[model samples]
Target: MECKFLLDDFHVFAVDTIGHPGKSAEVCLSPNNYDYGIWVSDIITALGYDKMLCFGGSFGGGILSKTMCVSPEKIEKAVLLVPAGIKNAPAYKLLNMLFPMIMYWITKKETWLLKCILPMAISEKNIASDTYETAKCSIDHVKIKAGMPSDVNPEDMKNYKASTLVMAAEKDCLFPADLVLPQAKKIIADCTVYLITERGHMHYLTEAEKRMIVDFLHDN
Candidate 1:
């Protein structure tokens, strides 16, 4: 979504994660092993970039972390946004979010489901009619797998060589900022962490936040 902001200043490659609803082949690498790292590295090599900045959010963050662990040399810098793999969603939060969506899936109650989940998933300031419609369409059509990515091993993370910027959403149910910050600081050799306030799992970045990210990438 921030591609517009970066387009003039950087060459952005927005890869559709495999198995998500996109043109990419539906071949998911196992998150429990190094397969994800290998898969992403192959893509980068294919794309002909010797090294580049990598930005990932949510599920993409898990894949990026795996890449960082196994092939840090390929990344110039890394930016992770409320990423998975730092920790799994707390069980109660998972159940609360999933139960209604599952019921909607079985019963085909689209309106009811959106109402139930939107407040939990998005901050009030971030809500927009167009974005809401898009998200609804994606959920309705996408064939998604139903599990949080496996957690990253702190031991593996010690091998990471790239400078990293991590932005964690304070209200993020999937990966709480409080939990992710400490673990990231412990593992990543050169890391900067920011806790974004009044944001949920799905966030809207203000101009200041956008500028912060651009500055980070440029500085690194």
Candidate 2:
């Protein structure tokens, strides 16, 4: 069902985020500033949409945080899946990944790539083939992101009133549910959080969970 969401009656619109792949400026916007939110706001206005539902995961969720901070009124509802920008674990926690990543960069070996990703996914079983391949290709090609978006000031989110859904994983090395859920509850006014028990960052959703997300997003 998720596969058919691209051009179905729900009219889901996917935009290539600025500075990522596809048609966007070569410049990477600063996550700490309001630039990302402004860019998103402009896109919404340019498309002549008064309000829209939004979905984002991981790095993209951080960008959505910026949008909520900048243009909360423009969003009808939001689903943040394994989102960032709430409380990202410090970079030191990720030192285990550095060696394998460098080795992969140096050797361009798929084995090394797997090693590079293992820490995030926690186990090979959690790493879907498509997820692995996409990460492999993206890493080989896309320029590395500079940093995660900074924690949004509570005051910045004071005006955000859109109903929001957050799905966070318990063992996410980068944005653990312990960190993300509490803050999400604290900052988002009308928020619902679902913890993916025992799962890490790369865990896949069950079909029922996938259907739940689709249903939520489809509810205009």
Candidate 3:
């Protein structure tokens, strides 16, 4: 999704995440200044948003959800879409360590790797020609956070108190519904988990999915 879209719709303030393009981890790592969570906390205090709603797609979802664990007092609600924070899982932990190595080895032709991996990791029905481009665009945008950090501990996830909504695609190979469904139940025992039929790992928020999220927010 585009940043301008949110700016037009909500009182949106976008802070580029680390590891993506345009955002530098060095700056974001400063607790006194720009650490992702700290920066968000600073914004909340400065803007007088004592309780903010958190929403993220893909990796953004992972970071936003973790922020709820680390700084739960600042969040009122959370929405995660194909979020990537299940560090406790072996496959994910392996991906975190291997991704950099794989990237280095693949060189400029890295885009090819995404084409293969996205479909294999996610469900077959969700793969599309545009999916690789979209994934590459996001990688080119969000900065990488230090700590080579990946994966959210299951315990921290279980402790989160914010009203939560998680949507996963039934066909998503990258972050499958099987993993996500169980994680959602553990993270927020009472929250609703909806599976998007015939969708994949792509980040295009569909009208129905958007409506579901809006409804969840309205109810909670």
Candidate 4:
């Protein structure tokens, strides 16, 4: 698991939460209990980072939100993309809880499981060729070795206090904007929400968004 940021100027340290399938790098402060927010706090103190801005995408949003909740003093500002801590759909939660256990048992049947899991994380129509390939690579790794658990209770989100700029995809199927934005607004009254047109759950750094994010980090 790798948690690196593309920052040419200033220090940007990315923290990975548990059960992130190499996407999030899963580093926690308390290795025994693995409390996500406490781990984030530990990371800040351990790394000697202070009054920093944060940017989180997908499940990284969940971890960042938790990080703010646990250590609100550390975060100066935050930009969240497709944050995944809030559970709007009951059925999705059930499946997410079961995925790791089921994957462990069905080790040989990788393709079938991938088909089931991929659709949950992305819209069927927007599953780009490169995205599908990357997802398959990660899913294949999970099939071979069941990943860690990164699930967070909704209460943790309710406790966050960061002033956040949250963006959601209009056509996102994995983490719907309608559902997540409301939860974010509820969690932090200072949160601002934006719905991007025809985007997916993942927020990649194209030339424009990268510049926007860099400017945001610098200004904040």
Best by TM-score: 2
Best by lDDT: 2
List, residue by residue over 11-54, the lDDT tens digit for candidate 4: 76655455555565544333212366676777777887775777
What lDDT does candidate 4 reach at residue 43? 74
lDDT, each prediction: 0.79, 0.83, 0.59, 0.60
Error of 1 at 118 (Å): 2.4
Cα lDDT for residue 115, candidate 3? 45
Candidate 3: tens digits of C-alpha lDDT, residues 41-133: 666678788887767766576666557656778878777777656422344534543565357346847655554455534443444556556
> Residue 188 of candidate 2: its Cα lDDT?
94
Ranking of models by lDDT: 2, 1, 4, 3
Each model's TM-score, in the order given? 0.90, 0.91, 0.68, 0.67
> Candidate 1, which ten residues in sequence have the lowest lDDT sum?
119-128
Identify the runs in model 4 with alpha carbons over 4 angstroms from their true place. Answer: 1-5, 16-34, 93-134, 143-161, 203-207
Candidate 3 off by > 4 Å: 1-9, 23-39, 87-149, 157-159
Which scores higher on lDDT, 2 or 4? 2
Q: Please, what's the RMSD in Å of model 3?
A: 5.1
Task: Write down the worst ten-residue block by lDDT for model 4.
Answer: 143-152
For model 2, the run of ten residues with the poorest summed lDDT: 1-10
The total of clashing pairs for model 3 equals: 20
Q: How well does candidate 4 score on lDDT at residue 133?
A: 66
Error of 1 at 197 (Å): 0.6
